[model samples]
Target: MTEPKTRRTRNGARLPADQTTPRYLGENIEKDLREVSERTGGGTMQSRILVAAIALFAERGYENLNMRTLAGWVGLKAPTLYNYYASKEQLLVEAIELGMTDFFSYILDGIEDVPREDRLFEIVRRHAGYKMRHRLIARANDRLIDPQFARMFLPEDTARHFSGRMADYRHTVEELVRDYVADDALVSPKVATIALLSQCDRMAYWYDPGGSMTPEQALEQVTILIRRMLGIAA
Candidate 1:
């Protein structure tokens, strides 16, 4: 197979896209981060900068990450950085969208031929797993209350574009949950589903890979939590 292209974190350092560091915790995190950055642009310089920014924002509040400091982290002149991202807010919005897309893709990719009840559980696990794994990305997505993200990253037209694709996966799970509730396979499937999504959607704010939890361990815990939420007695 052809070698994959090299990618960089925000610091302009060269790192292989396939490589995953302990700092990032899992291969999927790096993969997802890079994929999202590539959606905006290519190369290690751009991707690494975006990854660094997310990691920083996760550590420090958004206000702490001004353009000068962010540019310094990426080893670029702050003004030149604007060529890539118009402003810090715009950059944040794009990153959030990329993060969401990365996560939704993972959850959608895992759905298979299992029964509807089991399918709902699987969806919960994968969605939770992704969030617990890529907490920074998830957190950045959650921090999208800024008007820029609402107006720019997720305009009605953009939301519709995302929905057109995301709808299939979302609808599949919703219907599965609805059916499970009807069949008594689950209690409060709708509530369970929403809660599960919330759990996955806010990983970035609280998940610290340096802390006591590993991504796999977090996934396991989240899976059990979601099962209990669904009254599945896991």
Candidate 2:
């Protein structure tokens, strides 16, 4: 092997195009990636802290959630979390936003392009199963969304961000109900939809994954009830 070719930059530094990267440049890229990850909290330990924070917030609610508890869950010193999130409120905002994103994404993704007639069953099933399976998300979402809860206590910007997510969730569900009524699958569109959603959403309040009734069984009963109430077939 004589010598690999190289291209020179304006400063006369050589780069082996598509062949090899300079050691200094490689180090710089790695450094930048780490910096960005730190700022964005996408690093492994940082994300773990967020996960723990969400779980704690869900299990204990905001007032009970503290930096020490969050740090304990992430297996880090309390002061170490500052390296990722600026404060507990910032952590709460990020975790709730992520949780809402997951909740809506899972529900909407399941119902999209699905006919209103079929959507009834899917919604009930998804709602029950999600609440049962993702208890932390269920608890956290419920607490954050209580009309007088987070909105009244959290920072204005953080609270407003959560309010937007809550609004979008309501709108999407409303649209689904409207579609159902337009298709003649449901009567008393708004009233019936609200009633039915309240029924499904409240399951999280009492849902026990370890209980005798599995999520599927509970969903089946709720679906049957809603179908009967709406005059939907099966």
Best by TM-score: 2
Clashing residue pairs found in predicted model 2 = none
- Candidate 2: minimum summed lDDT over ten consecutive residues — where? 19-28
What is residue 41's positional error in candidate 1, in angstroms?
A: 7.3
| Tens digit per residue, CA lDDT, model 2, 3-24 | 5465554567544332122112
After TM-score superposition, the amount by which residue 3's alpha carbon in candidate 1 deviates from its true location, in angstroms, is 40
Candidate 1 scores a C-alpha RMSD against the true structure in Å of 9.7
Q: How accurate is candidate 1 locally (lDDT)?
A: 0.60
Tens-place lDDT digits, model 1, residues 143-182: 5534454555455765565456555655666677675455
Candidate 1 clash figure, as a count: 9
At residue 220, give the lDDT of candidate 1.
Answer: 72
Could you tell me the TM-score of candidate 1? 0.59
Give TM per candidate: 0.59, 0.69
